[model samples]
Structure formats: C-alpha cells, structure tokens
Target: MRNHTSVTSFILLGLTDVPQLQILIFIFLLITYMLSVTRNLSIVILTLVDFHLKTAMYFFLQNFSYLEISFTSACIPRLLYSISTGDRTITYNACICQLFFTYVFGITEFFLLAAMSFVQYVAICKPLHYMTIMNFRVCKRPIFCCWMTTLLIMLPPHSLGLDLEYCASNAIDHFVCDANPMLKISCSDTWLIDQMIIISAVISFLITLLCVVLSYMYIIRKILKLPSAQQRTRAFSTCSSHIIVDSITYGRCIFVYIKPSAKDEMGINKGVTVLTTCISPMLNPFIYTLRNKQVKQAFNDLVKRFKLLSKN
Candidate 1:
C-alpha cells in the first residue's frame, strides 16, 4: 500500500481554517470528549458491578457504551490534538488506522442497536419467555455476530482502499480520515470503491433499521393490546430510552452516508459529523441513565458503596 502511493502523510484540513475559531472548537471538543469518555466509562463500570443490572438489556447497554467511548475517542482526540498543536498532518498508516477503527466501531453499533431492539421486543411482547429467550449465552451471540458481521462488511472496501493511488493531493477536506473525503483526494479510479461503500452502507443501514422498526412494531402492538392504561405506560416507558438513542443514531448516519449525493455535500457533512462524533456520544449516557430507573438505582448503589469504602 505504501509503495503504490507517493504521499507519505496526509494533511487533515480540520473543521476550520481560522485560528481564533480553532481555539473555540478545540475547547468545545475537549470538554465534550472528556465528558463523553467519563460518562460512558461510568456506564461500563456500573453495568459490571451492579447485580441488579445483570440482565440482557444491560448487557447490550454495556457494549453500546463501550462503542460510544471507542467511536468518539477515535475521532475527537485526534482533532483536538490537531487544533491544539497546529499539526494537522497524519501519517498514511495512521490515517488508515483511524478510518478503519472509526467505521468498525460505528457500524457495529448499528447492528448492536438492532439487537437491543429485538431484546426489547422479547421483554415486552414475550414477558413469560423473556429470561429464557435472552439468556446469557443468547445475549453474547448477537454481540459477537455484530462485530463479525461488521468486519465482513467493512474489510473488502478497506482492502480496496489500500490499492488507491494518491498522486493528485494529500489534503483530506474533513476533520477526520473519512472514506468520502479520502476518495475525493485520491488519484485512483474511485468510482467502483465509492459505489461499493455506498452500497454496503445502505445495505447495513436498511437491514438494521428494518430490524428495529419491525421490533418496535411488535412492541407497540403488544402495548396497545394491554388491558390497563398503567400497564401500557409501564411497558412503553422501558423502551423510551432505546427509542431516543436509536432515532439520533440512525438519523445522523442517514444524513451523512445514506443520501444519493453525499460526496458532493462535504460542507453539510462536516457539521453533521461533529454532531455524530462528539455531541451525540456525550448526550447518550444522560439519555439512558436519566430516563432509566434501574440504571439510576444501580448508579446510586455504586456511589453509596464507594462512600462506605472511603469511610472505612
């Protein structure tokens, strides 16, 4: 791959060119990145230590939190460093690594969210069989499949990316090493790989989205059929957090990647990418924990345990 390309390093243009604006962007990204990592890490720790959280729902939540941490960490820290140091140049290998990890984690998240939707469906629509249906062994299988399937979907395009020749330019137009921006700067015939990326992204997006939609359809139907209003509300409440997260997750990605003319919309993509990579991750923990009674109780218990340990 290195031998084929004349460019040894690519300069990331970053979010802005103005030095003063860069400072503001850097501070914003820094604060959000710190908060995102801390909140997501707390979720991971809470799920692991809390006995009450030992269920299939929380198992998926733990993995989702991990993905949030990883997806944001991949993009934001690098941009923050570039903003702080005035060094926007990233090595060829480093750029590829960033692109690879970001997609792998981000795409796996779509599948995981779909799996979470199915878990919700079973818990609501099949209350008697919920535990038996989503047992520990059953829970682990979807998570594993999500990772493996994402790899299978991502590897071919990424492998083809290695053969791309970049003699024309070395400056990627976005803040991160995204595929579209990288393709725009390459000298190779990117039409085939570009189409492939779009096809894979659409296929992934639609299939997972269909799973979520279908699961929610069944859940809503079950809730509507409940005898009491209180029973319906209680059942619906359990799904609210997942629904909100799913909306934001899918909405952002669809705006960026699922459009017919995404490549030509670089200006809009940058802003959406910021929201996707930084703002969304920071908000997700609050969305789940604040809305979720079980998670909140687990968090409180964990905090109490810490205080008791400190006093001793």
Candidate 2:
C-alpha cells in the first residue's frame, strides 16, 4: 500500500495527442460548457421564482440543474487548462477527489432520473393520487435519497481509490479521472477492487434500469386505458423526455464501463465514456427541461419580472 503523502500528481492523456485537434476540442467544449451553465442556471432561477413551477417535477429539476453545473465544473475547466497550457498533469489527490464526485453525480443522476420517471408515471397513471403522493416533501426526498444511496453503495470504490498505490504510470487516458481509469493506474493488484467496482456499478445500473422499465410499463398500460386523446398525448409527452435522456446516459455508460478491459475495445469504449461525461450533461437540461412549456413560461415570466423591476 502506497502512502497517500508520497504520491504527488497525475498526467491526463486527453482526447487527442495531436496539438491541432486540442485547440478544436477546447473551442467546442468551452462553448458547450458555457451554454450548459447558462441554460441550467436559468432553470434553477425559474424553479425558485416561479410559483407555478412549484410542482414535484420542477423540484427534481432544481437538483438536476445544480448537479449539471457541478458535473461540468468538475472536468471542463481542467480540460480547458490542460488544452491552453499543455499542462496535462494533475495532483493525484485532486484527481481521485474529482473521480469520486463524478461517479457520485453520475450514479445519483441515474437514480434521480429513474425516480423522476416513476413520479411522472404515478402522476399520469394515477391522477387521483398524484397530489397526495408527490407533495413537496415527498418529492424532494426521492432525489435526495438517490444522492445518499449512491454514496452509500459506492463506498467500496471510494475506499479502493483512497488506499490505492499509484507508483506506476500516472498518465490517465482521459482528461478527467474516472473509476476505471484510476483503477488502471494502480500499482498494486487491483483485481479485487476492479471486481468490487464492476459489481457495484452493474447492480446500480440494473436497479435503475428496472425502475425505469417498470415505471414505463405501468405508464404504458395506464396510457392505453385512457379514452381521451389529450390525456394520452400528455402522458406520452411526459414519458418521452425520460426515454430520450435515459437512452443517452445509460446507453453510453453501459458501453463505456460495463465491459471488462481484458476484453476491451478501447476506441469505442473511450468515445462512449466521453459522451456520457462530457456531452450528455450539456444536453440533459435541454432534453428534460427546455422543451417543456412550463419551463419556458417560467423563464419568460422571470425575464418580465426583471424588466419590470428595472423600470421601477
């Protein structure tokens, strides 16, 4: 076991080793990051200020916006710094902390989305009980539970990371540290830790998948029983967003981390990992919130309120 005090830093093996492409990536990522911040922050503001958006749905969204902000903050700034300064190195302690938070948010978000889907399923499928079930207190608990549960379940991964001996090659294949990548750099035999991580991740992923699948199964059955076209349309509209976001997050995540590296397809796997961490967080705000009329209305009202205060 390597003493934590002895290990200093790590090197990132970013998207392309090519200097020319680094510039292009920086430009593209920075723009996407900026837009994501602006959009999510806007959602956060609207959720707080708009009385109409005080439902369970927007309550969950407020947490999502906050996570998306921190999620991007965790990696994008480091990527920008690495690109501009050619400083691909990070202190080993900082690298592990980053990886932990990234994993925390990813897992938490998976279950949060599942929780949100179930909430919608209940609201649409059991309209009589929607208000009783999804009150403010009831609503926030599920999202918060996801965060707490994710942390509890992934304790082993964190323990492994904390005690890791990283005396070997410090060069990480991605700009940000992740569980698989961080484990790859361990100087000690990481088979136990790797199996622990894979088992936990698979179990977490499967549980979330089951929650979403069952929620939608119930939702679909409910939707079919509805006689009104408008009711069915509304139900489809709510669930469709979940289907899109889940497909992106879980689809890419499964591709990236599920396969053991002894059977690795490095190129394809790496691309999927990047998409999950980098691309999906940016798009999630849009897919889940921006297209909704309620969100748009809240935002517009916020702008109008600001302008009225300015005139006063």
* Top model number, TM-score: 1
| Alpha carbon lDDT at 104, candidate 2 | 84
How many steric clashes does model 2 contain? 0
- List the candidate 2 regions with Cα displacement exceeding 4 Å: 1-6, 257-264
For model 1, residues 1-312, the per-residue Cα lDDT tens digits are 433458889999988889899889988999999999999999999999988999999999999999999999999989988999899999999999999999999999999999999999999999899999999999999999999999999999999999988875799999999998898878789988988888888868999999999999999999999999999998888898889999999999777655557556887788898998999999999998876888888888989999999999
lDDT tens string, model 2, 112-143?
A: 87888888887887789988999988887787
Superposed by TM-score, candidate 1 places the C-alpha of residue 132 at a distance from the truth, in angstroms, of 0.5
Q: How far is each candidate from the true structure, as Cα RMSD in Å?
A: 2.4, 2.6
For residue 271, give model 2's deviation from the true position in Å. 1.9
- Model 2's alpha-carbon lDDT is 0.80
Clashing residue pairs in candidate 2 (N, C-alpha, C atoms within 3 angstroms): none
Q: Candidates' lDDT values, in order?
A: 0.91, 0.80
Which candidate leads in lDDT? 1
Q: Model 2 residue 216 lDDT?
A: 85
